[model samples]
Structures are given as C-alpha cells and as structure tokens.
Target: GSSGSSGQALASDSEEADEVPEWLREGEFVTVGAHKTGVVRYVGPADFQEGTWVGVELDLPSGKNDGSIGGKQYFRCNPGYGLLVRPSRVRRATSGPSSG
Candidate 1:
C-alpha cells in the first residue's frame, strides 16, 4: 500500500515533467561505496529539495556483530571509482549483470 502510493506519486511527478530522465526510474540501482564503512541505503527524489541523483546515508556501526565497527560513518559518491559511479558507469553495469 505504501509502495503503491509512493509509486503513484512518482508517476504523477513524472507526468508533470517535460522529460523523464532515466536515473529517476524505479529498480535503478547505484552502487555507492561507503566513504567510511557503515550501513548504506537508497534515497529517493523526495529526500532532496532539488536533485535527480540518489544518495546513500551511512549510520555508525553498532557494536552488535552486524558487520560494522561502531563509529560515525560518512557517505559520498565518487565518480570513476568503486561504487560512487557515474550515470554512464551505471548504464554499463546494468547492461550485463552477469558479466563480472
């Protein structure tokens, strides 16, 4: 229900747009490496005041064997390296999931 509602909202926004960009579509994944090791997740257009690119938010690793060290973690996107990939890189990665 929540997902459906969100999807509808996104659709409505897209309809209002003059052009639909490829990065805003659902199921689009960007592998952004942690600037400092921590939990990582996706952000949607709603998360930002203005921007099309999604970002990762890192939480400090809790000392509970969750596979992280407890501390303040930071997140960022670095083009041309690792998970902080550019749109062209994402397109290349998506073109063949099983290639590498």
Candidate 2:
C-alpha cells in the first residue's frame, strides 16, 4: 500500500478539481484547492489589484492568512482564517450540514 506510484496517482486525481461555475456567488460555502472549506465573503476585483479574487472566511482555524492583502482589508475575518483565491480554485460545498 505504501507505494510511490500510488501517491503519484492520487496527485493526478486532485488536479482534476472542478472549476467554479458562473452561478457561484459570494456568501456561498465552498472548498478551496484540495480541502480548505470556507464561506465566500467577497467576490470582486481587489482595490490594490486587478483581476477578480474571492475572499473566504475559512472554516479551519489555521486555514489562511489575515483578511488583509498588502495591509488593506479586502474582507474581514479572524487572523489565520481568511484567504483570497481565484474562483477557479473553489468548488461548491454541500449546501447543508452533514448528518454524521
């Protein structure tokens, strides 16, 4: 079970992460990259930059950096629990809480 090729296969599986659909909007819950889950707080062009960014209030305690980028507030959240990522990096999360 501890084989190198299997690890490589797993890596490729993750590379197929689904793109964010056009209907996805801020305030929706989503998972970023592989396993970071958060609520989208802001979805627009940042003040100090061009291109769109999605500001997420991460569910994990150490999920991300503070909500500031270059010392400006793009969105607000506790330190180590905010992240700005391209919408492409996000995927829709379950709409309701898990039963288990």
RMSD of model 1 against the true structure: 11.2
RMSD of each: 11.2, 12.9
Candidate 2's residue-wise lDDT over 1-100, tens digit each? 6656544333345544334567577789898888888899888877775556888999987556778888788788899999988778878897777898
Using all chains and alpha carbons, the TM-scores for the candidates as numbered come to 0.23, 0.68
lDDT for position 19 in model 2: 43
Every candidate's lDDT: 0.30, 0.78
C-alpha lDDT of residue 65 in model 1: 27
For model 1, the run of ten residues with the poorest summed lDDT: 80-89
Where model 2 places Cα greater than 4 Å from the true spot, the runs are: 1-20, 47-49, 97-100
Local accuracy of candidate 1 as per-residue lDDT tens digits, 1-100: 3544444334445433333245534344433343323222322332213333323322333212221113312233232111222222223123345655
Deviating ranges (above 4 Å) for candidate 1: 1-20, 33-49, 53-92, 95-100
RMSD of 2: 12.9
